[model samples]
Target chain A: MSEHKNHISTYKSQILVLLTLIMLTVLTVVITSVHLGPFNTAAAMLIASVKAAIVLLYFMHLKFDEKIYRFMVTLVLAIYAVVIIITFFDYLYR
Target chain B: MTGNTSTHRLPSYLEYQGKYTGILGWILSTDHKRIALLYLYSQLFFFLAGLVMGIFMKLELIAPGQQIMGPQAYNALFTVHGLTMIFLFIIPGLAASFGNFMIPIMIGAKDVAFPKLNLFSWYLFIAGAVIILIGIFSGDGPPDTGWTFYAPYSLKTNTNVVLSVFGAFVLGFSSILTGLNFIVTIHRMRAPGMGFFRMPLFIWSLYGTAWIQLLATPVVGITFLMVVADRMLDIGFFDPAKGGDPVLYQHLFWIYSHPAVYIMILPAMGAITEIIVTFSRRTVFGYKAIAMSSLAIAFVGYLVWGHHMFTSGMSETARLVFSFLTFLVAIPSAIKVFNWTATMYKGSISLEPPFWWAMAFIFIFMIGGLTGLILGSVSTDVHVHDTVFVVAHFHYIVFGGAGIAFFAALHYWYPKMFGKMYSKKIANWGLIGLFVGFNTTYMPMFFLGFMGMPRRYYDYLPQFADLNLLSTVGSWIMAASLIVVIVNLLRARKGTPEEMDDPWGGRTLEWKIESPPSLENFEEIPVIDSEPYELKSK
Candidate 1:
């Protein structure tokens, strides 16, 4: 418990991550405005995923956390990915 | 054990003053235990309300042609029935009441992470409950939009759809906060040496359930908000007029709802795990497997929500994928079922009331899950979709799974909670009546459903009359059985007292304390030096 305090990331890395997230969100909104045909929704979601990664890694502090915490986050994301992919497949095939 | 000194300093609530005795103290007090009692009383009220609605619904179908009520009234009856049972009865009945009382004690903590938030959650639950009841009485009409509150119909309906859906939205917020509190408490507040695996199975199950509640609840929150927006403001998320897809609504609803079933069952499963090992007088066969299966079920449960939409014109490939995933989810459930059964084999088994409920849970849930596989098959589900079969399948799991498990836990923990033992003889009679009445009530519905009796209908074809008559009779019997169980428990509060701690020779830390324990739970936090359910000391 004592070691965890010193191991916490400094202020600079936090600022960098926040900046990156803002840039990604702006890029997503811009992409949505442009008519990319069927690719618009996909492009928006991909950018949103990038933003989510920054939040998970920095704001939630998963980057500097133990391996088990990383495993838990990855496991939940994998399940979500499977459900989304399967539902999309159903939509496409029908 | 110094009896005189102990009685002189009995916990504040237990001091038997004549002024505020019996039910008054239970309903009016701020003690967590008494508040839990309040939740128990209110939940029973709604359970009986739902049960009466169910009886009337079956009665109406006895010979069709609006036998008991008009079509509009019938619609209101079934709509309120589903809403009351799901939101008001089963969801909060087991988890909120029992979880609030036991989680703090189980994990060697004084109270939940946020004690005021705990009380706030209960008040919010009661507020939602009151709104639903007001909808029932106002005669502006109860919500006939079904518990799902599917749109287009929801937007146009003159029923109390807005009030009921708003109630559900409020209930979701309450559930989310409870889950958040449990998550933080479990992670941060375990006693000095109670490691991850060292915690009781009930705690692990609550840990898993809290995650489901946190993750899945937000989706439903967003879905309900969208429904309100569409109905009140004509926002176009689910309106086909605005090019919004209605099927997308089903997707979002089931994504939360399927995991919501796990949310209902997981804590009950945790309760059963504890009951099984304690009564069998043996270690659980696969402790880690049972724990991990809970996590597996929670994870796999989210992916299979699509199976609910199989006949809703989903693509063939999507149907096939959901079908496979649904079967995959059942595997973890099967693993849990087998592990519980194996724990009983070659071990000293006691036929206590809790164990009886546990055994019944296994029997009925197996039937429910197996029939679910049939529904998971794309072709068969198309045949039975929206029929009485679907209703019967769901009731079997919800009633037989969570409902039965609730009874088992109540019986298992009654001594610890009240410091007195119930009459096992009467409880046994209650169990038999419940089993007989339950099967009689639900079994005929499957046949009627296959014969094309649509659910949520006030009137039905004359051909299905006899089965409806049988089901109504069965419901009456079930109601009678429930009354008997409640009376027996109430009577137990005055009977002969038992030895204070570990009445059942239980292994968990909870039984290590005095019955109806001190408010802070343990006088000293216990260090875990061995796995749970290890009967023979090493």
Candidate 2:
């Protein structure tokens, strides 16, 4: 029940995060054009994951929030990862 | 305690008038108890609707030659029945009604963390139900793709699948919000000294159910939207001709639905635990075991969705892995079942109506759980896939496990909820009919299914006619008993409220309050200092 003080990002940090997101977006499109063979989907998903993390940490303020929030998010993502890996069992074998 | 003393007693939630009067007061009130009642009445309405549809489907199969309706009508009947029962009735059934009513009081809090959001969730539930009904009546015909809405046929069917799918998507939102609200309430609103371990087992089950509801529902929500898009916008999500893999659709669908089974039953197990502990007048035997088992079930439940797709063209490796996971999931459930039985081992047991319902739940759940193993194994499941055996197995779990547990909760909490005591004798009689008739109806389906009778058919072969006829008669008996149960409860509302606050001598925090608890639940918030179910004899 301890309410942590709200954290506001400085303008410079916000601008930097936005630029990084833009660069990742450009890199995603450029990488898709390069055709990494079996790694194409993997490369795109990895970039998307990084961008999502950045947005969550800065815009969603997970970095400033209590550690429990971050732990919960990681738990959810881990479960999702397991589900996806289980789904790939079919594709990989078939 | 005397600081806020008044000459008159506080008004119970039912008697309190608010900004609006009459039904408006009920619908608009942010009271958790009123919202729970809203869910209770609405669930009953939908349950009866689904019950009638089931009887009609049974009647159609009475003689095995289209006794009541043709194939198409039969299809529509079962589809709507499945939609209504699964989405509108049982999925949100116990948790929304009893959870909303009891959670705050049980935790020694005034209300949930988000009371307004709780009421809004109910609105979303009704809105979703209305949209599903619109899909039924206003369409070219009711969606005949079955409740599963399997692809290819779902896409090709002339019936309105989009509206129904969209309706389910909306319902998913309601489910998610309810889950989110419950999670936050449990995390933030416990009374002082009420640690997670000290909280009631019912709350623990709800915590597990909320996590499942929040995490698993969105997968199905997005899947439903994709189905709608496939039907309306021709996006080819599940359409094979358009290069979409129908099996992928099944994957996404079962990813949520398999966990959805836990969502339906975990609260049920929790309620039974409370009832058993109260009636037995003993501390629960394996408190942490039961609590941890609930989370275990929720976690393991996610990995077993592939069992449903065993025959749906999944690879051998995936099928084996899923089958193994399915069997693995049963260990935690068995842990819960064992814990409940051991709790009553050497205690002062009261054979109350609620206890009877709980006993029936265990008996039926054992059958359902054992048979689930049969269905979980890929070999046996391939034999009974889409057969009546699968139907019988799930009915025992969902209907017998969750549905009967709902009745048990109603009976256990009736005096505390409505401030009136129904006749225990009549309730037991109703249970007799329900137990006997429910078994009669579904038990034969297992034999019929093992004998190769498929489900959702308007008519069956001559060999299946006799058992089908018996099952139809069982439905009639069940319907009659439901009438008795409903009438008995309704009649009791006219009687005087019980003088004792704790009619059953229960030990939970809810029993410490006045019957039909006052608005805001507590005049002075209680500071918890003991265990949830510590009996005096102990």
Candidate 3:
């Protein structure tokens, strides 16, 4: 393992990330309030996914982690995506 | 190897102390092993509680006219039976107890990535168990809304649905935390050179199971929260009048609940894979294929939840697509089954108790999975929805598939866990008794269901009396056999000699260590320069 102190992210960057997440959550709530027809739900989820990704990548340290961890995360997300797509298609086409 | 090394000598459970050293040590300890044992003890308690409920259910069905309990009592009995068995017994029985105990050891780690979180999960599990048990005794009665806790009935039921759903919510958190811990442990804590493919199939299955637990569990958490809101706050998520769709409740429920089946069975499949390879003295046929198929099943399992919603007014096209995906999910399951059997094809095979249970799991699960195909078909599912066939199908999968696999794993690893040898003669008899009793109890339900007998009924028509009687009789035999197996294993615990390392000539890393392994598992993690089941070289 490399020197732990050197590898750790700075406090300022952490604070910036936290602020961005807070801003995104606020934006999500505000956007939900605006009537965007069917697009409203989709928009909220999209924004939520982005915020979640940010937390997972930075706060959870997936960005700094090994490639295998990234692979595992990616694989699980890919599978989740497949499930949602297939279920949505079945629901819609039917 | 140092022949005179003190560590070479085996350590008994009493002498084995890594973190906790005494009786109080176990009760309040946070060590993963102690937590696992705590889970084992509590799961046994829940298993027996569910068993008693099952016996009462059978007794009520025996005489046809509510002989043992009232209609309300009967409903509560079956409902608690389902809830306890699913939430308390089946879900945690294999994964939490054995998974917690074995995963770290199997991966050659000192402990789980989150030992404190493991203990916290156990506490949460016990808390949830107590809440559900409180509901059972409250006299207002247990939740009669079924294990699914489906709405309208769940919200409208006079029984303590709030406590039950809340208990389920807490249990879901316990499950989620366990999943999160396992994922991180598997990802980050594997011993120095243990690569993804080098990990045991059990770890692979758990990795898959943890994902299901993380992704799918939250949905059920939200669903149960919605149920609580409906019941307590009257928020009307499932209220047809309040513009909420009851069908939406099911869609949300099975979204987690269906993959929840995979959560229960996938680890059992992993355990069976390990047992089959060990007993047969062969590498698992298509190791990579079996491992990949595990991930495939977990992925596809999520899409097929709609198969459960087919008869609930889902569109026919949706049903058709779901039916196809459900069948596709079976392909990977079939691949696993084929790989296991082919591993056993020409290799040395033992008829040990674990092997017998594995064989039985295969036979029973084959029937269960095939019948599941019949149910997955929308048209046939419509006929059998809520019938005893659905009950029989799932019992075969859950009880036969997961339940028997758990027993098999217990038998296979008992020597390692307790460092003593159970009587194989008794085990053989116990195995036969269980197999016979299991079939006798469940096989008739298929016919009863085919004859249009609906499930969850307190009192059935007289036409169903004879088969019910036979089923009840079989349950008694099963209970006796199960008791005998536990006794036989416990009997070996006092003063018996410690078992040999590689007692079964297994090729896995776990067997490479001493029985009742030391606190740190390995003094030096062995470099994995060979295949997982390379028996010939050994």
TM-scores for all candidates? 0.92, 0.97, 0.91
Residue-level lDDT tens digits of model 1 in B1-538: 1011133224623543434667665544545655666677778888888888887777777676867788888877778888998988887756787887788777777777887677777788889888877776775667878888876788789887777877888888888988888888888887766788878888888888988888888888888888888878888898778988788888888989899999989888889989999889988888889999998988888888988998777888888888888899888898888999899899899878888888888898888888898899888999999999999999889998898988899999988887889999999999999999999899999999999888888877879888888888888888889889989998998887776557787887777677877656665565566666667532
Off by more than 4 A, model 3:
A1-40, A47-94, B1-7, B10-13, B17-21
Q: Residues B197-256, candidate 3: write the lDDT tens digits.
A: 888999999999999999999889999999989877988989989977787788889989
Off by over 4 Å in 2: A33-39, B1-8
* Model 3 chain B lowest lDDT segment of ten: B1-10
> Going through the candidates in order, what fraction of the true interface contacts does each contain?
0.83, 0.91, 0.39
Number of the candidate with higher DockQ, 1 or 2: 2
In model 2, how many backbone clashes occur? 0
Higher-TM-score candidate among 1 and 3?
1
Candidate maximizing lDDT: 2
Question: What interface-residue Cα RMSD does candidate 2 give after superposition?
Answer: 0.5
Q: Give residue B103's error in model 1 in angstroms.
A: 2.0
Clashing residue pairs, backbone N/CA/C < 3 A, model 3? none
Better of 1 and 2 by TM-score: 2
lDDT of 2: 0.91
Write model 2 residue lDDT over B387-414, tens digit each, in one string.
Answer: 9999999999999899999999999999
lDDT for model 3 comes to 0.84
lDDT-better candidate, 2 vs 3: 2
TM-score of chain A of each: 0.82, 0.88, 0.79
